[model samples]
Target: MIFMTVICTNGFSRPNTDPTASQQRTSILVLNLMPNKQGTEDQIISLFEETNLPIALTFMYPKSHVWRHGDQADLAENYVSLDDISDQYFDGLLVTGAPLEKLDFDDVDFWSEFNAIRDWSQTHTTTQLFTCWSAQAALYTDFRLPKINLEDKIFGVFENQLLGTSLPQWFQIPQSRFSAVDRTDVLNCPAVSILGDNQATGPFILKANNQNTLYVLGHPEYNADTLSTEYYRDLEKHQPVKAPENISLTAPQFAYAHWRCCSRYLYQEWVKQSFLLKENNSHEQKQLQF
Candidate 1:
């Protein structure tokens, strides 16, 4: 059997020429909230590719959200709305981070719609993975946890200690966020487990809902220069952003990706766990019929 990444946009046909082979591929729906749509697609697809998993991808965006960075026509053509896939069930759901950290969750324009999609995932998807802001958002929506604005953005790569047995003892992850969930609240919560954390970045990874949902507060899928690009972009926009910390001083323009190994391991584990959960659920349903 050949293993390849098959990416299909909304209303688009699967590119896998072999119809029978497509039936065996895992389906993952990505809610791309990042401003750079294509870039985020490449990063996510790369992670799955490294796992060597035969998967079919469907990219979707909130219809309530207005296009700001990319072309509206392109997004309308390439992305699906939550309503479009209301009847479908996915093996996995990936929610990308947005740049709206400073605003309250209720203040975001698509806040209601975001909650709708999040609610839908509870029943429609087997496993859900939330990154960065979406991670914080999930904590808020489910646990009543509040996000605290950092005095300074937690920008740059930092080594995180794994709190669970799923990953290595230590792994570096790239963080670029203006806020974080309260560690005390997470510690007090009963539904969630802190999987990985850093002293500076608080809880970097969390799992809840019987490990069916995963939250990553940093960008593990980030490329080597993602942080550098953000740093320079902020400067150009005259945003009050500091130079990313923990990067080489002499060559700040290029940041090395010390997090790729951990990133791949994380995604691989998630996919494996997702498949197991799906199978177990399917078996449970069959038993219920008897």
Candidate 2:
């Protein structure tokens, strides 16, 4: 059985609770696909912090040496493992993209583990969010769509994501690198909807399966310098890379004007919609007392 617990540290302070009236908060499992455990945790935790929603976070890693990158041993210092979904049924899931861009996901050793998690999530999780590679993984698992490859890596804040009428309030695409392995023909699935897209960014943000699974093709959970760090690191390694175009290093002097406003509106709308979920998802672990 999976042991259940809340990630309480930093500012996540929980006091005495009103058992009956308490809301059941969402459990977000950061299936950190990035091999660098510590770094990935830093990037992912920020998203939960932003939501201001009472949440419990757990991290999962693929075991065995099958196509793993970075170093999992280093990540083990802070990471934890669990065996089952009974730990606590989650309301949402966040899956990260990995650095492995050159291999087919199915060929990778962790493919089966990811497949199992994806399958379990469909019925167990209320909503799921996949980032970059995980987005591709989920797309393939649920709909058998493959990611399209690009000759050039799409880096930086190239604004193409937009919020539509149906978008939730808490949804926001923070500017980051959207290095996609490929694209899939989404037209065949009526349950899938695009929240953000750029021919350059591909499907930057999207919602699938009646909003149960929210798929973000980019890394909005990234820190301000996350893109810059990756860019500089790649350049140092002499790997092919590009600068993120049109993001503010300082306060804005010049802006895209129209595109900026549109993106802002999309973010605002998401925040509005997200509030309700935040309210409803905050739950107490034990049964109501009063």
Candidate 3:
């Protein structure tokens, strides 16, 4: 039996791929909203490192916002402008979380442009995954769901249970957000179905259109020390911040990547479903041709 390798920056073994299967690659577009674009890219990329499917990722940044997260020269050469891909379609779309959760949706620097991009994703992309602030933004933009600001940040690894479907089963995710949406609000949204929930952090996943649209409230892509780094950064600024739960903060060392297994599993499942939908659509098109 012949096997194919999945390419990823992280040095992990790829799942076996059937040689007879179609080699069509899945195209994924990421809208990076974090302050550190490269870090966000690496976190998201690590999730698919061990997948069996072929994927091509395109990174996009808001043209209206002028913040420097990394070297401008490198960003220009490596990433595509959001405007360039507005009219294009992708198999998967990922919208990363931002640090501006305290600000009103309209107050965001690139709110209008981000709104346009969000609108475009509804029809142009097969599956959309909105994380953290993007998830809150989508809820507000599409369903009028309001986000409640937590007095303290929800920073740490928290356990969550699946609510809707059982494919993902159960998992824990790393969260570092200052705002949260009420489980009741998600329950009230006509277009969304709650997929996962936590007693303390409320709902995590909101699904719509048979999981074609997903609102993930936590950062499943975060590496173990991602939170630790953020915590120390906040400390340096003299901001009052608490240590991440389930991980050591005093040692300031590398923490175990407990979320890695579930993160990879969820991403691979999404890729599998996206390909299945594409295949079904092709079959229907061919049937129409006959």
Best by lDDT: 1
Q: State the displacement of the C-alpha of residue 206, model 1, in Å, after optimal TM-score superposition.
A: 0.7
User: Residue 6 in candidate 3 has what lDDT?
Assistant: 34
- lDDT for predicted candidate 2 compared with the true structure: 0.55
Better of 2 and 3 by lDDT: 3
Candidate 1 clash pair list: none
Model 2 scores a TM of 0.71
Candidate rank order under TM-score = 1, 3, 2
Could you give candidate 2's per-residue lDDT for residues 1-290 as a string of tens digits?
22222342221122223443224545566677675656666545544444444556666666544324554564443343435343556555667887655577767777887887787766566556687778777877876777666567766565544445254433334444434523357756676766566655666666664445656666655665666677778889998777756556452224333333434453233333333444565322211110
lDDT of 3 at 112: 96
On residues 118-153, what C-alpha lDDT tens digit does candidate 1 reach at each position? 899988988888999999998888777898887689
Model 3 residue 285 lDDT score: 31
What is candidate 3's TM-score against the reference? 0.84
lDDT values, one for every candidate: 0.79, 0.55, 0.72
TM per candidate comes to: 0.88, 0.71, 0.84
Residue 142 lDDT, candidate 2, scale 0-100 = 77
Against the true structure, whose TM-score is highest?
1
Lowest summed lDDT across 10 adjacent residues in model 1 is found at 281-290
